[model samples]
Target: MHFELGFVLLFSIATAVAIAARYFKFPYTVALVVAGLTLGVVHAFEPPHLTKDLLFAILLPGLIFEAAFHVEFRKFWKNKLAIHALAIPGVVAAVGVTALILSPVVGGLDSVRDFGFIHALVFASVIVSTDPIAVVGLFKALGAPKRLAILVEGESLLNDGTAVVLFTLIVAVAGGAHFTVGGATMDFIRVAGVGALIGGGIGFAISQVIQRVDDAMVEITLTVIAAYGSFVVAEHFHYSGVIATVVAGMLCGNWAASTSMSPSTRVAVESFWEYLAFALNSVVFLLIGLEVQLGSLLASWRPILLAYVAVVAGRAVVVYGVSALLRFTPERMPWSWSAVLTWSGLRGAISMVLVLGLPEGFAHRELLVNMTFGVVVLSIIVQGLTMAPLLRRLGVSGLKDVYQEKYELARGRVGAIHAALTALEALRRTRDIPADVVEQLERDYQQKAAAAEQELSALKQQTNRFHEEEHQEGVRRMLIVEKDALLKAYQRGVIGKEAFEHLVAELDERLAKVKDPEGHVPLEQSSPSLPDAA
Candidate 1:
């Protein structure tokens, strides 16, 4: 099919499937994967295959960008220890368990009764990463806790990198490419390191430039280029393309939050990514359902089941056994958290990519494909659909709820700030806001910004033109001290002193700015109230 026509057809199919999934109260990602399986089957019995480079090259960058760009890095960090436990070593251990137990069932590798250990390892590692976009979306719709949602989502994000690195090493070994612990380790380090530098460097540069500009359109376009270009550049240098996109995404997400971006740019970029992820994920899954060769898959069920058992048991040992040790000791992570980690693992598209991606002439490719496909189908249909119930059974509360309450509160603050900004916007049109309030707003916003870019984006052209670094920094320093004093007073239970001092400080500062642009006042002049506030 022509590229344009193909996209239209793909989109149409996605739209139809999405509607059905939504109408039936089903997970869209699950629905889409089923749809792709159907499509795979259709192609299996036919002359042509639906899986192609276009499905990835055209759709994937935007999807990756959307997920990475919008995900809050701060929250992801909050749960990194737990996320690593479940995604990284967890994947490797699962692979080992599957290979050891399922060997007999898979049959005859190198004229023997067992599937080769290495091959099974490849399949397990490849399938270990989670794609929870559809399930997470449902959680959001169901009003799940934000922390659960982020834990699941953050793990998914990191595992893509972990899995890719693992997959690459496995593929190299399978293809009889040079295999060395030292070489492989070196290769991984270079790929991950170079990819991160390229992606993060570009993201940081983009953030810097974006802060100076007010145009939403330009910022969105830059993000698009960052997503695709970062991948291509990294891949060209033989680095991890997925990691490049991820790093770029993390950096961009950080900037999106800070005052560095215009409100319109933030909204535009967010809207663009959300839609893009949906479109790509939808089409990818639908094609999965559309093109399945069910009978061929059925033929491979024996090995698939065996492999599934191995993987599950392995995951259990690592999750419950090893994790139990961590719980009783220094880490002190709740046992309930580990239980949620096991159930929360929901694998999707990337696993399928590797399942189908084995080179055509490899000796054991068919067995690998069949077993991989079977395990994936089970995970998606069986484990996936039942994850939430399993979590509740294991006593894991919805982290999404925690996140939602936090989000609502944060968003409320955002809303109020937006109101202030709107008021500022209106004041721009009409000289209603006092001149002092306007200047205070600009410099005050700058220092609190998470990064430099956010604060700079809030500046008016006039502020830039008449910019005085000396005056701006001094004003910023004074305001911060006064703000600190107010908080300290509140903490000390001296409400009257707090109010009186804060009010005097605010009035005097505003008056001082009106009096002299270059003069400064230090925060230390105020009597301290409480240590925490200071």
Candidate 2:
């Protein structure tokens, strides 16, 4: 297919799949992959291959930035120990364990007995990065605790950089580069550290620029530069581009978007990125399906299955190990989260792209590709299909009831009606409409607004869940106000340093409990005492 025409076709198919997925209540990304696979099998016009160049140069930075942009650094930092442990060392351990387990099993197979530890290690590294795109949305939809979602998302965001850096190192070692434990450790630190520095510098610069501009388009363009520019510069210096992009995105989203950009501009920028993410995700998932050769995959089903099992086992061990260690910390989570975390490790585009980028003459290249592709497909289809049920089984899914939806609709209607009334009043003042007509319209809207508000109130009365939600919302707002006041008081020297820190810490704990109500004691039940400044 012509390059231009291929994209047109892909987007059209994605549009159709999106509509169908929504109608049938299916996971849209999964459906796209399935659509791509079906179309490929039926010899639907050949789509452009999902090349490493295409992914690394274009799709990756945008996707990473978009995801990272929305991640509040405060939330990410709260579980820093857990997120870092799982993403950095946890990923490395998982890779090593996967290799150790897979090498002997695959060596025992008569078909490819030569698949050694290094090849297994390489494959493990490729697949260790979790793509929780499918599951994160489900978490929100199912009302899972926000902290749990943060852990999953924050880990994924950081691990992508770790996995990519590890993959590069392993591939280098495989290609005859000298390897040493100390050297590799230092190299990883330097690459990641320098990338972070580069990203922070670029992000800070862009944020400065954004604060000086009020135009939405200008601020949005600056963010785009921060995202791609950081990646390109870091990669050009042989550093970790993924890490650079992620850091840049986090700063821009949490710092620039919040403090610098006006509300309207922020909304515009956010909307643009959201649509871009959806578009990029659509193409990537669809291409993942088209890339797989069913016949080849079927022939390699034995290794694929074994590899998949190894990956899962490896992840499970790491998750449980991490969970055990976390039990002593403030960040400790329920043991059941280990199972969810392990199962959520579904490999996606990064694995596929890295494997494909391997040199043509690399040992067992085709087999490695086949194994990576097969495992990616299996993980997405199998795990994605079952995540909701898994959440239900674990009792982690919160408020998966109809009342939540009805409450949301009623609340939205009330807000919309109020906005409409505001607009009507503005028109009544400016337009030459008759007084009686204006009065009639005003009465009509008032009645509609009252009806919507009453409906919302009744729904809140109908369920404690609604009441709890409203209470939590109100509490969160008040806590934020208190925190803001505390910050200003400390800054103005109205409060002592120790007292400010103590009060702020208390407020943060309360906020955390409010956000993850299922995991912590309710604020109502906790000691609510505050100490005075000395």
Candidate 3:
């Protein structure tokens, strides 16, 4: 297919799938894959192949960067222990366990050929990276805890790099290249570390540039440069490009975007990345469906089913094992989360691209490819469809009530109208427009704001969670005000350095509790009244 025609077809299919999925209340990405599968079975107009080059050079960086960009570093760091455990050693363990389980089983299968421990290891490495896009979206919609979502997302970001590194090493060893356990560990460290440095340097540079520029377009462009540039540079030096992009995205988002960009510029940059993520997800999921051949999948159904079971079992062992180890730590989660974590390990485009990238001369390449594709499809369809019910069954669905949605909409309207009124007042002061017209506009906005507030109040009465959330927000703002005042006092020499540090430290402790009140006092138990600085 011509490049232009292919994209149009892909996007058209994506749009149709999106609309239909939303209307039918289905998972959008899964729906896209299903659509692509139907089209593939029918041999619909040829679509562009989702090759390794396309994924690494384009899709992977964008998707990874977008996820990393929105991830608040504070939230990520709070769960750092669990995230790292699940991502690094947990992944490596899962890979080995999967191979151990599958190697014995597959060696006995009559249909499978030349697939042993080494081959199983390669397949395990390919499928171990969890693609959390679908599950994360579901978590947000179902009102899962922010920390839970962060753990899932944060782990995925790091594991993608880890799994890719592991896959490369295993592939080399399988290809008869000399390898040792210590040598492999060193290689992983060197690649991952260099990639982090490269990404962090690029991200810091981009952030510095953003601080000097006010234009939203330029800042957005710089973020794009940071995402792709970090990946390209790291890859040029044969380091982990996935890790590089992820680190660059985090730095740009948390450090640069927060410290430098104006609110409007930040919004613009975020909105741009959001849309890019959606578009990339749409095309990639669709391509995943299109890439599969039903005939081949059916022929290898037995091995695929076995491989899928082994993959799930491997994930179960790793997640539960980590949860057990964390049981005594501050980062420990409920037993239920282990189950959710295991189920959320859906394979995605990265696995597909990795398997496809295998050399044609590689032994058992076709079998490996079929097994990988089969597991990816099964995971998406089976696990994706059941995740919501799992969340509900486990009592982790925090709040799916419509009242919260109504409250949020009303609250947003009030804030937007207030901003508009503030802008109008500034214009009136400058005499940029007639005072009477400005006065009339201000009156209109004030009325709308009043109505929005009334609606918000009505909704709040219907849900205690909304009220608690508001109380938390109010307390946070007051704490921030206190911190700001203390900083000003110290700068102006109105307070001794010791006094300032002590006061600020107390305020910061309070702020941290407010931000992550997991073990702190429940919001509903406290007074909803805003704190008085005096």
> How close is every model to the real structure, measured as TM-score?
0.72, 0.85, 0.85
The runs of at least 3 residues in candidate 1 whose Cα sits more than 4 Å from the true structure, single-residue gaps closed, are 1-3, 36-52, 108-114, 325-333, 391-534
Q: Tens-digit lDDT track for model 2 on 354-449?
A: 999899899988889999999999999999999989998998887556877888899999998899788778878888777788889889989999
Per-model C-alpha lDDT, please?
0.66, 0.89, 0.89
lDDT of 1 at 4: 66
Candidate 3 global TM-score? 0.85
Per-residue alpha-carbon lDDT of candidate 3 for residues 28-77, written as tens digits (9 for 90 to 100):
98898899899999997888999988999889999999999999998788
Q: State the TM-score for model 2.
A: 0.85
Q: Return the clash pairs for model 2, or none.
A: none
Q: Estimate the overall C-alpha local distance difference test score of candidate 2.
A: 0.89
